[model samples]
Target: MNTLNSNPVHGATRLNDWGLIRASGEDAAKFLNSQLTQDFALLGLNEARLAGFCSAKGRLQATMIGWKASEQEILLALPAEVLPGLLKRLTMFVLRAKCKLSDASGEWQLWGLTGTDAEQWLGDAAPQTRWSLGQKGEATVIRLPESGAQARFLMVQAKEAADPALNPLSPSDWQWLALQSGLAWVRAATHEQFVPQMLNLELLGGVSFKKGCYPGQEVVARSQYRGTLKRRTFLYELEGQALPGQEIFHSEDPGQPAGLVADVASKDGRSLILAETKIAALASGSLHLGSIEGPLLQPRPLPYALTEPE
Candidate 1:
């Protein structure tokens, strides 16, 4: 394993926790369109989309950042731990669709770029908007929502391609920056636990209410228009360690779980956690990491607004 360590303000780090999936064939785009929350059929060459792969009950099985490499090929970036199982599950659905799904993690490299290093790597070709795509030689870069004022980016290139030479960044800082952006990729521990809305995925452009039928389109759509949603994901600062899939508890209702930890990144003694909980729980009582006596969770503002689109 290649570990890069350097200043947190500006550097590039190998994202070992992420995996790549490639979908190819004449029906690649169309087949993905029918299974994911994003409108893959209309995906553009210059844009990437945040999407959710859900179960029939509308729980997210996996979440991904995907883009079109070509009309016949689409690339998806997701948690490596969940890749094999997801790949197997998706392959089972491609019976006669003319699409081939395979694990591409070993054939490609993924990197996380932060601050000036991100800007320097792409220079004039850097993508400005979130989820936008840019190209610099053989590397494909996707702009991500900023963590505070520091810009963030994801770069993908062939496994044999030369690595970008810049300062090295520790994995912890890279993960912290990603968590600060309030975006969480579904991991194996979190599989089939949350609906898109519960993670505020729709708020982050991860769900398409207007798209055609998908695995759980009706459930997702109903959650959107049926009534006011009572649960949502929020950013929080915890003084103690926390991990994804851990149960969160409320002070008022200590016997039962108030929510689930969607993602967590710890550095030093503090941690940044993206947890989904009851919206009402935020309004009154306190939240804890495991039990009512577990680490206290302090609410933090999200980088993006949570208002539902009109």
Candidate 2:
């Protein structure tokens, strides 16, 4: 298996290394369950989940990859750059909660596996934390049920035993999977610019409609139930750093910005970008960037349908 390594936790696909926050205390699950879009309290022992922390007005503030280490504790994996703001925001609501949140990325290692089968991954005898993959696999493979998408992203504590023989994926492999799947991850440029649904979070299980109140719940619910959303994320190919949130325009409407690049990456000589755009702009193949007037923003298939009009 192709691989890349990080000194903090050597010899594995240190895929997208990010900051980890360990939330602990009697009210940990309860507090987070009420805050994030996912029901963290019901998270299985060997499972990791994607959740969003949004503003009270139903705008996304942060996106998280979390796993419950115990009934009273959960490890929240989020971008290091986005951590400080998240902690401060979370602490603001700590008026009467029984939870303590701390930066914990230093003590753990995360990995991703690809170009190999799940059976082979299970055979590698590493006393690793078996994360749930849901309907995507053995609750270990990250899979999208409605979309039938399957992939594996795993984590290991730095102190734990990790064997290189497991044949993990290279960082690029993890990236390619995301690009191919047509998923757009928020980056520094696109930070705090989108609500969860704008990036198709509900389709990816990153948003929970049935969950109790949390930041941005009202707007998220409204967008889903009433289909009042004005924009949505899309996949497009270009060249160069796909500057997250960069504008995509068309020659016909050069005066007005058409779309924004949500994520960008260097693939071969071309760049693949996830852009959020209006349905009207995308219907026509007139999207352009720079002087390339006719460079069409070809729409790629997403894993799930956008929640539609009521």
Candidate 3:
């Protein structure tokens, strides 16, 4: 991890750039304002938003931590490897809207945080502290700092001459936090593979029931209202190594893959993993990995509760 500002950011890997793309123009807000599940219209100059970029059918493309840099400029911070395909898909919809989507990845960077040290650390070091979702920026870029007991943030390039703060925490710390958050970044292997709801986007605030129409809005809404959601994401802990995309098995069905590992973090020898699976497949007791004798997965309660269908 790249070290910047003496590693003031906790729960962050290297002080590195999270690929940020700016979609700016007269039609920008009008365009995206119509899309995305979150309310971009409510985002103030310094405020940041956590949103999902979904396919026209409503499956997730890539998740975003977006902010309004200016009235005409909005910045979306996302995974770099996933940016190219996302950009291409977003560009296809710009046929009529006067939006200009371009790669601003090299021009800016990102910083992540969690644990007790994140908030106070950034407050002490980063310039201008408009920390939460509606925080006003002082000619600088600050994504909404999560305003809770669990802390996180993404710092952007404030000016043309500005750059990322290099200080970073240990890679292990970052792994731990990502696992806790249950983030499932869209990789090539998993791209367009799982629906947003399957990744627990609804529970994570990545979906807005009150928001207007966007791609897949109907499907997302149906899943919530009808409650026929057979699959959902769950946080799991295992005694063995947790591999991303690795198949998890059940004692009842050894022939079918029950779920896939989304992300993992190692702490105290036992590893925590985020897995997407069928709700009926998981239970309180032991579940075999491959054979009925494989390591069992212990279920843990999420930080928040799932909203019941209305």
Candidate 4:
């Protein structure tokens, strides 16, 4: 097991692994609403949406935390590794929609804030609801699901803006806290491998079924209404390291793969993994990383409950 250096409980960390995509034009919101899993047409300034961009087969290509920057512009924050391809594909669909998609990573800086550091940054104006947006001068603050009791937030601001006044939090600790929050953002390695529900996106308010049609709307809808969702993302603790797209094996059925790692983060010799696996495979509670003989995985309770499809 690799031991990670410990970090302070309250501080801010610049998220270098994330990037921004800007959609600007009169049809910006309309264009995004037609392509993404969430309803963008009604996206409000004070709210943020956790949305999925999917393929025609319903596999998620990218997940985004997006909000309206203005009436005709929306900003999407996603893993930097997937930005180039995702931006290119999004632009292709804009043909004559009056929407222009471009890489905006250079225009904005992203930061991950935790615990009291986030509270101190927003002062009395902190947003209380998850996915809610608040502003501190020029910075846009979005409240994310907490990591246990510690509050977590994503702050976005212009590159020229002043940095938040807080101690520095290490990147490893910030990542660990993100994994603990049970939200998995799609990375390049795991692209097109899961439907949004497989990662509990709907439970996290990342999917909007009533929003009408999108790229994979029919497939996503069928999965939700058919009551055939046998796979789900779950949290597990392991002694060593794991990576995205790594196969997870079920002890009883080691001959074949049972799941894939959606995201993982390690700290102080232990790692937390968010994996999507068949629900039945979890019955025996025997899972392993890498191979069947690899490190044993211990199931951990997610912060939120999974709701059954009606």
Candidate 5:
């Protein structure tokens, strides 16, 4: 981890790593609702959803923030590396649905705002509530839940428009804040590595248990009801860099990995990681980064409580 300077610019920045996917036509909402874990069919114009696109085996391919742009159009924000392939795959499934999926990355400029004045900077465009939407001029603003040491919000505007006046933050700095928030964003390195529950997606209101079937709906439901899931995501801090998909080792079982890194960011010479690990290992053994001889990890409390099976 690198020690960050006291400069205020670290608080906010333009987000270039994220891209957009646009779904258009009459069946946009219905198609997305069937494919993702969120209940998009009922999503109002003023609301947004955190959703996951999974594989048939229940592994997550992408985690996205989705919102309705109009009655016939929906926009999804996700990592750019996974967007192209995901859009292609989703297009293959629109056999009869009146929907079209396209990569609309070039159509929008995404910005991440954090710090005490994050809301005031957006003025009327700042969403008044979490998971809600607001409009300012041509920009669409969504207030992300309080993450890290400050408030955070995501602003999306047309590419042809002028950039907002907020101080620019480095992509790395933004990532650090996001990791500290305890919300995991799936990237290419860890694609299809874990199911929604392993990342605590359900606790974040990303999963809808009463919705109809999607790709991995059966496996997700089974894990929720049968008490069959033994692994879950947790926040940890260590003194070295921890990359996504890196193996986590336990001293008691050095021959095999105990878990994998889901998301990581460095700050003030320390690394923060969101890891999916076996619950038993968390209780009985000491966990290390990378390998058995790697740096030790200290557990940290998550921002939200985990939902236990009923």
Candidate 6:
């Protein structure tokens, strides 16, 4: 495992790829808790939760970081490409629930911060632990898990109130760090392609096993207790660019695809990706990116331990 020195520094980057969905109304929390994979009804202001919206068959349609902005309002942050569709789908189910969902992407500015000086940049109180939430001026800062060499946080502020001192960090750098952290951010191309466990959502606290039934809850529970999971997400590095939804083929199984790329971050000449594949194929076959004849991918250790079915 790779380790970083405990020393922290100050760095900031604009996250243009992310957007927010604001859920506000009398029944916001109750409505979301009943629809998503996280426990939103009990989400406190001091914490954030990683959550997933899955299809009826248990395939993840979206993955997001959700936090309670107020007792009646919750904010969900996710990749911008899927925000519009997801927001629409979520609204369709609101029907008579005392909740209103809307796209708040233009109203909020999202930023990524790293180093010990992060709190100083936000000029607000910041959380002390991973996945914790803090208030900074008009911004909500949520500390993200440390990835590879740096501790990180995600800050969401009203666009008009965003600080100008926060320097822009490369989006690719942010993506690489996120990939290293082993948390998959589902994008449009990969939507409805993975179950929560296949993306290691459970390990990341994205799934609440004790929470009341949500979409695909039954399938998810059965997969957990029946020990029927055969595929899981893994991290890998390759020497070229790759996109989400790209197929991976094992050398031994040339006629069949072994996996699909979940997410990818490329910098300079190399790319790092999260791929969901058969556990058995990972153990015995040589995986190639794109196709059986594509570039070979070297498997890298995930930051967290995977709980395989017994």
Candidate 1 at residue 307, lDDT? 74
Error of 4 at 154 (Å): 0.5
Off by over 4 Å in 6: 1-10, 119-124, 164-167
Clashes found in each candidate (C-alpha, N, C closer than 3 A): 0, 11, 10, 0, 2, 3
- lDDT tens string, model 5, 63-155? 999999999999999989888878887887888999998888998999888876677777777777778998888788888866644678888
Give candidate 1's error at residue 302 in angstroms. 0.7
> TM-score of each candidate?
0.95, 0.82, 0.81, 0.96, 0.94, 0.94
Better of 2 and 4 by TM-score: 4
Give the Cα error of residue 249 in candidate 4, in Å.
Answer: 0.5
Q: For residues 14-72, could you state the per-residue lDDT of candidate 3 as single tens digits?
A: 43535878989877776776777677766676456667777767777777777777788
Report the C-alpha lDDT of model 2 over 100-205, residue by residue, as the tens digit.
9888877766555443354344454222332354322222233222211443445444635454355555665456455655556666667677877778877766
Q: What Cα-based lDDT does every candidate model obtain?
A: 0.88, 0.64, 0.64, 0.90, 0.85, 0.86
For model 2, state the Cα shift of residue 242 in Å.
Answer: 1.4
CA deviation > 4 Å runs, candidate 4 = 1-8
Off by over 4 Å in 3: 1-12, 15-17, 115-117, 124-149, 158-167, 266-270, 288-295
| Candidate 5, position 154, lDDT | 87
Clashing pairs in 5: 12-169, 13-169
Estimate, for each residue in 140-193, the C-alpha lDDT of model 6 and write its tens digit: 889887786577889898888846375566787777777888888888999999
- Top candidate on lDDT is 4
What's the best-to-worst order under TM-score?
4, 1, 5, 6, 2, 3
